[model samples]
Target: MCRFLEELGVAHHSAGAWHWTSDTYPADAISLRAVTSDNFVVVDITNEEKVIAEVAFPAALLELHEKAIYLHEARQYQVEKMDYPQRKAFVRQVECDYFTDAIDYTQVKILEEFETCPLGAARAAHGEVRVNRQIVGFKKVKFYTNENVGAGALSLPEQEMHTTSFWLHFPDPFLARFSDLTPTEKLNSISGMGNALRTVAALLLMCDPRDFGVSLTEEIRPGLEGFEPNLHLYDSYPGGIGLSAPLYELRPRLLAGALDLIRGCPCEEGCPSCVGPAGETGARAKDGATRILAALVEAGLESGAAPQK
Candidate 1:
């Protein structure tokens, strides 16, 4: 990913030059002069702001920084000026990871096997028919990271891995939104569903403003706190858009409209149906929903304007 970024004209510096001895370094290092490079991009992927304070790079530098982008994308770092309060510096960082192996597909098959198949119409009157089928489909999984001060002491070799899982069900109100969804939206729903999806995506893909770092939160919930390799039995609902498990004609349309509304929303964190009330997922779902919707629209316009397949 770093190489890909370099090819994209991103600016970066090696971590080899970073070595800190004391607290005095962060403040003292700010005064050091920086050499003007070819593209004038400076990338910092470490939590070395104290040292950054001492280094002086030309303002012309693009500052193509790289850290765990997810951590600092939102907040600003405070760099104290000699006689001033502080300076706000905005930086962008892109993070990358290696793929070990594909997720086990058997898990998806298992999910299908356990799906609660809908029963057809029980009995009909003179000319009437009755049918109420349950929906079965996959929802999202959440993930979190911990950067707490003393938490690292609990690890061996100092490592943090994906933790906790929430397979609990969402109430009908949430599912009702996706009753009629398009195939495109259903697949996108995995990572681009409601306001929560957008917020989580931003949380996952967005870099921190300080040093562009990505890490999971310490919070835990089934659908809101674990990483998903593949959709599983625990990840599915009773009625909705599920291709292999079961097919419901109306499910896709229902889901599509609700998702469109939420995704099309225009809010920062989220609004009503999209992200849900702030009490539900931390922020209003509207803001996040709008972001996700914009992405879907853009993708659709690019993919030959193909309808959900």
Candidate 2:
């Protein structure tokens, strides 16, 4: 690789290593993760301007937005102002009963399908996708009770990336079984299942939860109305680090693991450890997701291929 770069006039061989020949450093031109090098500094300006903390670019929109509650050392601080141009947020110490949950909207477009398999009326696939994400709003939930006390709007920039993903596509025939469920209910069910799948995938891959992201949506294709809903588990890196392909090959095991995790949970409805938080995922989310997974398992069994542990 070093010789190739040197021959291409991109680098020079020096001290048994390759160094960039250009004025710019190679590391300065590339990002290691999805996060950018830019950051937002948190300043305490109640009495005098003092740097309190710094938040990364990806998290600043959600954590340092105006009116946001920033937590530091178990102490709560309310954001008084956000200076995006300066990449600074002014905060003041405050007491609050609840933290905030940012609501993000994500859309994934399939660029290429590398592999796929039929599971009853649904298809499991792995592919390249372009993800567009935007943090639009946030909700404040009271402590202990978890009741949403308030909501706030945000106008931040959208984040876009091309990544690899493993997804399950439920066709119309499979969705017909849940015709009785409202659209909202169906969405919640998909959300619950996506959450469970993310958790199981992280454990199976031995990777951090932040290494991948999950989303459920019916808009994988543009200008295609009434498309099937897809549950996507995508690598969080810009171009991916070879995670989705393996996940595609392990679809059966992944489904089985997710099913087992949800079933083993003792929650009556749903909790973050199982499906998702009951407040956001809905009371019937666990049951709905269970039914969907059970149907897939039954389909696998009928085909003489049950998902293995």
Candidate 3:
């Protein structure tokens, strides 16, 4: 695999080595190893769509899959299989199963055969879903494998949470877009989502409120006194709502519930389904939310709660 990657012009470094020696070698082992090490791009040669689904490859490398563009790929899946209502539904179910099962198998090394399906399924399901030079948010993704939702797991453990323990700072351009909303309104919406998520995380994980403070604002200010958690909210970069579970933590039902909610969302560009409000966020912020949402849904958190919008 290393040879193949190098031949394909992929770099060979500390992160370049593949862990093919494992029992699950070729499929999950390869992709898991690459993703875990935070490799920005992977030159995958497997003819399996299932593996592709598992890794959430960056949009930059999708040309290797064929010639489909990201936007077109998103739409092609709608009718890739006869456009039959039931088949479409089945495709989603199977996709959710494939992705979650991949996550489960990779993290725990428990179930093997079931998670080894080819990515051809994903390709067949979405004929033109190309992941090209669009800067796919592959790097911002993170994962945990557990059997319990709370016994030993977090409701939503986002990548940003793992990478940084900081607050959000709206870019001047993005902040300017909301000029009509008064600083307070902008602050409310921004911090409101964070507060809601922290509150929910504390409630779900049974962790002490002090550990994950309730505040969302940079500092306490006048008029926003009611949002007490605002004072306690720590700013996190690449932040957004998402779920984290150990290899043993996930159950089939919990995974299914998460997918159902994701497939049901109305937004085509992020939003609650794929991420948060895309048009309303900065360029960097837009990708993180959508990628996190997609990762959670793929990981089996379709119903992962988002703060009330």
Candidate 4:
């Protein structure tokens, strides 16, 4: 490790220990957490050009976008301008009764597949993927009632990321069982299943929910058709942080746990603890997700694909 650091011109080996080579403090140059290292600065332009807070890169698209409501220390600020080139957001204090939730469109393409297994009619795999995401708009929801009072459109540049992911591809034979479901319903089902997987993965990994991200897509790659839709759980960091491989290994346990979580939930439709909030995930999301997970579990059991430690 010291040799690698020395090669990077950051450290030197002397007296059986590694020492900083530069006059500047090494700690000052290094960020403790890789995910939060590249961040955007928020400036308050109401009174003066005062630095208010900092937002991480992944979150800046949703939290610091133009017209977005940013909450800090229990106070609310409205983002008036977002200068992506400058890596800064100009916001002003505002008294509003609602908050904002950004709506984004994401596409994931497999860059390289590391490991794969056939679980019944579905294929589970872990690999590197390139994610293309664009924040299209946001909804203004009232504070207490959680009512979406309004929404606005946004035109911003797309953000691309390379990360490691654990994904499930439902083959056409498996999806045939859902022939009665419309395309929207299928999409909703995938969304719900993805949410459940994210929750269960976090629990199994003993990590925070924010450490992983979920995405459901009909097209795993561009122009691909007749293939199964994909539900992905990716490490939410640049270059990843050793999460996807473990998740791939625990695929069976993850699916079974997700099934248990959804089946045991008390909500009739769906809640945050299960699939997702009913308002966003559709009315039949929980039911569809339950059925999908049950099928996955059943297939794994029939094939005797036990989780490998």
Candidate 5:
């Protein structure tokens, strides 16, 4: 930082500290959220159009997309149109049996690692990560039954953020245990394990599930041993909400809770309560996730690590 300022001729070195030589207040340039001050305004177009709510840039890509059902004060409002350039969403009140849930694809790149350790064969770590997400579609889920009633495609620009995340990665030795399963099934298991972990993590952290986002990727190598699949639980907000660091410390409890939840679920294969809806994930997602979690726990015990404290 000091070198950058000096290179720009705005700061000078004196008394072993950098002194600002420019007239600007650098604090004003710093922002807590990794975004501009612009926000998308939701306008109620039912009777006479009136401003209803405001959504941040990153969230607007998913929430303010055309055909999305926007909920405000327990009232359902279906988005009719979105003016991308103007950052406004036109919505009208409607009675509907379901709400919209956006489906997005996320990619995480590790920016910096804060801590890392082995939990049996798998490794656990927490760090700053760059998250890029694109909302490709949405699902309309029925209110009472929680069923996926319908879906529609979306075309929106991707959103990116730098946030803190807690991740668990599996190496080649761990992957060897699941060699009997097909490639797709292994990927599905990774996805299912991520889903279960996100739920249990929220419970352990005493925060709403929405506070964090989950993703599965084979791009990161925190262990530096090789490329491996890593399941990440990240803070949803830009920058961070200071959640991942504590979650890293509670790794053992999080894994245990997720395993217990999956094991105790009454559904024979899988359900939203455990791994995921049966067919959506693989047929054996429950078994796969259970095996992975149990192995992780048992490996920890055998090596005297047993996850983390």
Candidate 6:
């Protein structure tokens, strides 16, 4: 930055420091929020085809995608078609006992690790990352039962953001007990763990749930030191708002709280209240997430270290 400014004749170096000489304010030409003003028009095509609501572009993928169960005024409507090019969603009235949640695949590349430490059976780290994700599908979960009744595929644009995250991965030596589970099962367990952790983290931080995003590590390669499936709780904003560090500091309480929440939930398998809906997460999600958190808390206790907070 110093060299670039020097070449532009707007800055000079003296006393081992770069000094700006420009009389004009540089921030005058900058915009803080570059977010687009575009939004999706939700059209109710049941009778007269009236417009019901307008959803922002950022949230349209998850809420207005095709087959999504949209709720308005305590009434249910099924999205019949989503015209992406036109930014419109066509919906019809429907009486159903289920709601829909979008499914997406995400990959996080650690650009720099701000900090790292042993946290029970796993290692926890907070760092800057590049996240790429897309809305690949949606699942229909029963309203009260929380049973996944159906799902559908979607082809949507991939979104990427640079932010900070708190992540946990188990060491190869520590994964021996999970040998009974398959690779897919292991990843699912991590997904369930991400769900519980994100909820607890949001409550602890007193932030809106949408302020945080949850995802799993890209690959589950065996024999790699700590390259097993892992969970990440990341800031949804382009540059983080200082959430990851606090989460890292409160790791012990975070894990213990998640464990207790899942353990105390009355759901037989898994529900939105804990872990995740069983059908979308697989029937063993609750058990898997509980086992993982319990192990982490136990290991932390054995190490004679209390939560850093």
- TM-scores, all models, native as reference: 0.22, 0.85, 0.20, 0.91, 0.79, 0.73
- Error (Å) of candidate 3 at residue 125 is 35
Per-residue lDDT for 80-177 in model 6, tens only? 99999999999999998889999898898788888877765577888998999999998888878667789888889998889999988766665667
Best by lDDT: 4
- If candidate 3 were superposed on the true structure by all CA atoms, what would the RMSD be? 22.6
| Candidate scoring better on lDDT of 2 and 3 | 2
Better of 5 and 6 by TM-score: 5
Q: Give the per-residue lDDT of model 5 (tens digit) for 205-284.
A: 88888788988877644456554788889999888989998898787778888999999999987998889988789798
The alpha-carbon deviation from the true structure for residue 105 of candidate 3, after best TM-score superposition, in angstroms, is 46
Ordering by TM-score? 4, 2, 5, 6, 1, 3
lDDT of model number 4:
0.87
Tens-place lDDT per residue, model 4, 63-178, is 99999999998999999999999999999999999999999998888899888877788878889998888999999999899998999999789988899999999877887887
Instruction: Tell me how far the alpha carbon of residue 75 in candidate 2 is from the true structure, in angstroms, after superposition.
Output: 2.6
Over the full model, what C-alpha lDDT does candidate 3 score relative to the true structure?
0.28
RMSD of each: 23.2, 4.0, 22.6, 2.5, 6.4, 6.9
Point out the worst 10-residue segment of candidate 5 by lDDT: 300-309
For residue 2, model 3's alpha carbon misses the true position, in angstroms, by 41
Ranking according to lDDT, highest score first? 4, 5, 2, 6, 3, 1
Lowest-scoring 10 consecutive residues by lDDT in candidate 6?
28-37
Position 283, candidate 6: lDDT: 78
lDDT value, residue 92 of candidate 5? 95
Model 2 / residue 106 / CA error / Å? 1.1
Best by TM-score: 4
The per-candidate count of clashes, in order, stands at 62, 0, 35, 0, 1, 0
